[model samples]
Target: MRKLDKNLTETLRKTKYFLLDLDGTLYLENKPIGDMKNTLKFLRDKGKKLIYLTNNSSKGAHTYVEKLKNIGFYEEGDLVYSSGVATIEYLNRYYKGKSVCLLGTESYRQEMINGGINVVDGDRADVAVLSYDTELSYEKLCNFVRAIHFGATYIATHPDVNCPAEDVYLPDAGSFIKMIETALGYTPKVVIGKPNNIMGENLKAKFSENDDFSFMMVGDRLYTDIAFGKNCNFPTMLVLSGETTEDMIPSAEKQPDFILESFNDVKNYF
Candidate 1:
């Protein structure tokens, strides 16, 4: 593993946009990591643009904004972006206000509604958006199967199987998606989240004109967060705070540009 160094600070100082992960890199179990708020303030004070990159489609961007605000991160609306937002954007572009049925949390439904798309409760939808709904039920699965069988377009917010918390890992929306896929005999038409270009494209568009811009994706997951950055040809920082650990380094097919214990240690690189 590559250690954090002063050279990393120079590289970060040159970065115009900082793509950050929420769950593992900045917080754990709804609590901000040590010095995370201070670090964010420091970046903002330096006039560096920061965007919260998350694969957790269980909640919308507004929900995240509220959560962050409650936790003492005073961010404006544009600073937060979620997979839920990406899904809405995709649906709006292709379907153009089609009647959609969503198997997601309340926050996801709200996001769909905010995007001016109708959210049908049953299988009568024109398209079905599968997101991470922690309150998933067998009845909902039955409805999702029916919708897919009826030729409604199938979409997933993200393909994450599990999400890490402070206590233990929990079943993410992708696990439920697999169940529906097994019954339907095929996967969704598209998944809008990390390791995909949709989120990256949104980030790039938000921070346009990047002549001197460098990006570093800081997260704890190898497959999702790190892969997203590497796939986009951006530098990656793997912090040992949540899902990833030191022992898992050798098995990883892709490596990060730097590795630190947590966000607190990242300040040293600055």
Candidate 2:
């Protein structure tokens, strides 16, 4: 795999669409990389379509848009596809207005509401949806477990264990899933996010079929980002500015098509 540098410009020039990871690949914590806005503008100026693809289901698409705007990467009509949005889409298609018991943040709840799904209280729900909740507590866990034990359909937005932060990684929806599994003796029936068919279908619907399209997946995590690319037959680039560290390379289950220290470093290759 080649390191991202100025020589990769030809490759970038050839790309027609960019599916970007929000947390690690675009920003670290709440801070955007120095050249991030410019890089996005550069891609757009070259006629490439851009979409923000994030596994953090705690927030909705509009929330992501606001966050990006706050960080100065303002773009109109830019699509923000979160795992939460995908989960909503999945439920709408399959369950069709079923009562759901959700274990997620306020934003997630709002997204479910906006998506026309019903969020009910207690174990009587037809389905139990799990997403990243920053305010996760024992009480909420108890309620979710009860719902799961009562045979409610289990669904997870993503299987991300932890989310990258400026100082430390925060437990994601997958971590809570593990806890519930250990206690209930079962895992979620479905996980809709990166590396899943649901996300692929959503993306494919947005971009028309292209036999000659060269796709690339760029992100920081090996499991989610790189695995998604590898599973979907797209080239992957892993940046070291987020979760994957130098020492973890040998043990990585999936390898990236390219590796770079950061997005800026990759610019040199382009």
Per-candidate TM-score against the hidden true structure: 0.90, 0.88
Every candidate's lDDT:
0.81, 0.79
Best prediction by TM-score: 1
CA error at residue 169 for candidate 2, angstroms: 2.1
Tens digits of per-residue lDDT for model 2, 110-197 = 8899899999987778899988988787888888878888888999999988877768878888898898888768799999998775
RMSD of each: 2.4, 2.7
Candidate 2: residue 183 Cα off by (Å): 1.3
Q: Give the Å error, residue 31, model 2.
A: 2.4
For residue 126, what is the lDDT in candidate 2? 89
Q: What's the TM for model 1?
A: 0.90
